[model samples]
Target: MDRYLNHHLKISGVSQQLFADAAVTAIQQGSGGLLRRANHLARGALIAAAHEKNQIVSAEHVRIASTELI
Candidate 1:
């Protein structure tokens, strides 16, 4: 998970533990349709954080992104 986040998401400056916890929470709170939806939300969160000039994707970003999703 960490590797995918680092390599695929191109994110940095966040502790692996923090990111993992946020991801787990996002997945758990998701609609339970598919893992892909959770993953998409997570990735969108990272992008949102980046857009906000955040060095790392925090729980706040995930929460915001989750809300923006359908």
Candidate 2:
């Protein structure tokens, strides 16, 4: 999961990690271990973080994205 996150974020221009550990766990659980779902949630979390002007994505941001998507 960590490697997956790292590769995607790196290509997305995130030199440093954007997600907190708790957020990563939340995303994993929410994604149900599916790469496509994980990608969706991660993208949503990034948008949520950007909207809030947050430097890092938190579990709250993931929750917010989950709610908005579902």
RMSD of 2: 1.0
- RMSD, every candidate, angstroms: 4.6, 1.0
Cα distance off (Å), candidate 1, residue 26:
2.7
Worst 10 residues of 2 by lDDT: 61-70
Could you tell me the TM-score of candidate 2? Answer: 0.92
List TM-score per model, in order. 0.57, 0.92
**Candidate that would win on TM-score:** 2
Q: How close is candidate 1 to the true structure, as a TM-score?
A: 0.57
Question: What is candidate 1's CA lDDT for residue 45?
Answer: 80
lDDT value for model 2: 0.90
List the candidate 2 regions with Cα displacement exceeding 4 Å: none
Alpha carbon lDDT of each predicted model: 0.65, 0.90
